[model samples]
Target: MKSNFKFFLAILSVVFVFTACNKYEEGPMLSVLTKKARLTGDWKVEKRISASGDVQLFQTNEVLKINKSGSFDIFVADSLTRFGTWAFAKEKEYVYFTYKKEGVDNIDEFKIIRLKNKELWMEDTEGVQFNYVPA
Candidate 1:
């Protein structure tokens, strides 16, 4: 009976550790892949939701590629539109990007709502949510 109680306690502890490790609002529960590995890929917007309603992007095609080297590229209609450096901020809760435009530097950030192997969800400062899938 003592051994059984010990086993139960061990299981409970394991469960707590895994659940506590999840940092995102929407979560994977547990992931073997590191954050950078999971984020390094080509992703396209699957949906966009704003305070008003769902929005349809004007571009026929748009892709955002995040590299393992901390660089990112945004392509619109098969044309390179933006290139930048990206990093995780605020304990990995936000994705921060820096780029140059008109010879000046610009910074943008997105709060991560969910991050998984196949799906990424982020919300902008304007309360717009973007859902991305592997492209």
Candidate 2:
């Protein structure tokens, strides 16, 4: 009876240690909120910087809408209308923006460096980082 009790206690201790270790287990981390359930919401572009070489601050209340189908729409708050339609291409490694009416090919393409907690950092060829916050 004494030997049997000690074996049961040892087994319980092992199980407790394993469960304790898994208690802190977490899921994968994502850079962007790619879920359609959460993406199809209103967002503001906030501010932009022209990173030609130096950081130039461009202030505007621009709004952006990202659809569930990887489609996007951008609007300038001044006119409160769409500036263009943006498509998420190349596994979201690149984005293509095209104006609806102007069609001037005012395309601004950049590589997404990071996305976390509604904050996105995009990098240009010149190594300039554009910080975007959801408005």
Candidate 3:
């Protein structure tokens, strides 16, 4: 029947249109070759950028120290504070910033763009960029 053939064609057209569309990406996007060993060290935040491209630079004395023992410390001027427990999710390419803040309950995950011995770069889920360098 002509009507039956028309229905089949319509279905086929819809399928092809969907297949032709670009694939959608969900969740944090990270580099394919992010390894954990490059993350341990003392780093200072040289610059930070928001998703909208706003930038912030830190003072020289502030630093983030990541030891091989699994804890992270943040130092601002003369004050040293515990930032959180840190772990690398090799499969997801995210650094898990796990902590129990006074009122909040959840782990923060930052997608790493590049991690090297001298520099570390990451972006939050909101796309804010944090660039670090050896302190």
Candidate 4:
């Protein structure tokens, strides 16, 4: 009986550790893949929600490709629209993209809301939320 109680306590502790490790606001509870691995993929915009309660759904040919080597590319209708380098900031709570447009450097920071193997959700500084799915 004592050994059984100890085993139950061990399992409970493991469960607590997993639950406490979730860092995103919208979480998967647990994931075996690393954060980078989950973010590196071809993703298409599924929807966008503005701060004023406006929502837009996308059905166009747009894809965001994130590479494991810290590079990223945005393609529209098979044409490259933007290319940049991406990095995790603030202990992986945020993602920063640095790119150039017409000789002007621009950086966009996104706070990760949820990151899973097939889905990604992020919010910008303006409270606009973007949802992405594997493309």
Candidate 5:
């Protein structure tokens, strides 16, 4: 009887330890990828708006590549010279980006897609939306 009880206690201890270990390993409590985060890849500019509320649609195609390193290269039409680094901020359901260009800071606003199927939207700080068709 003494030997049997010790064996049972050992098994129970092992089971308790395994359960505690498994509880610690419960994957990520939540997904870190947001709709704004889905904007991680290369994107094309469908429209451009100025700070003065001017809108310009490019006659030629423009592309922007966002890298995991937080750097982006902007391709204006056929030119491939403009590039900059970007910073991200998370506030509630909104994600904001700050682009540093030629020593000037360009702050932009973006809205996170609450739904998984919706296309990601980028906006200026004032909430002007930029529809980025993912490349």
Candidate 6:
């Protein structure tokens, strides 16, 4: 009877342990990549607005590649160039990122306006708007 109680307790303990464990993980940084993060692949520029508020449609092939490995790339006129490593900027009201190339030591930041199904929109502080669609 005692052996039976011990076996039952052992099974109960196992069940309790399994049920108590949680699968979700919280990021340590304030700039979190939530489950809804959609900027994870290649994209092509469809529209761009300069600081002058002049809209320009993409004439040549301009592409931006966002990688899961914390890197980004730019393709212009069918020529691929390493943009550099990318990371979320400081915890501001909007989502933004800062990136620096291999040769340049300056980090450029852009504020994201929209990031959803097949589209991405961002702008620099100077109000240069950039819109992208899935490539």
- Considering every candidate listed, which one attains the maximal TM-score? 4
Task: Kindly report which residue pairs in candidate 2 clash with one another.
Answer: 31-115, 44-135
Worst lDDT window (10 residues) for model 2?
22-31
Q: List the residue pairs that clash in candidate 4.
A: none
For candidate 6, the per-residue lDDT at 87 reads 72
- Per-candidate TM vs. native? 0.92, 0.50, 0.66, 0.93, 0.50, 0.62
lDDT of 1 by residue, 104-132 (tens): 99989899999999999999989899989
RMSD of each: 1.8, 8.9, 9.8, 1.2, 11.0, 10.5
Alpha carbon lDDT of residue 16, candidate 3? 86
- The parts of candidate 4 lying over 4 Å away from their true place are none
Q: lDDT by residue for model 2 over 14-71, one digit each (tens)?
A: 8787665431112114323452333344565444456655565646577676666656
Question: Using alpha carbons, what is the TM-score of model 4?
Answer: 0.93
What is the C-alpha lDDT profile of model 5 across 17-82, one tens digit per residue? 766542112222234465336556777755655556687764547777777677777777667756
Indicate the TM-score of model 1.
Answer: 0.92
lDDT of 6: 0.67
User: Global lDDT of each model?
Assistant: 0.90, 0.57, 0.75, 0.96, 0.57, 0.67
lDDT of 3 by residue, 1-135 (tens): 999999999999987876654221221223343345568888898999999999998777888888777888888886886577888785636788777678676687888776766778888889998989998
The 10-residue segment of model 3 with minimum total lDDT is 22-31
Preferred candidate (TM-score higher): 1 or 4? 4
What is the Cα-based lDDT of residue 128 in candidate 2?
69
**Two-way TM-score contest, 3 vs 4, winner:** 4
Which lDDT value does model 1 have at 48? 87
- Show model 5 residue runs off by greater than 4 Å: 1-37, 47-60, 113-118
Clash-forming residue pairs, model 3: none
The list of candidate 1 runs beyond 4 A from truth reads 52-59
Superior candidate under lDDT, 1 versus 6: 1
Candidate 6 residue spans exceeding 4 A from truth? 1-36, 92-102
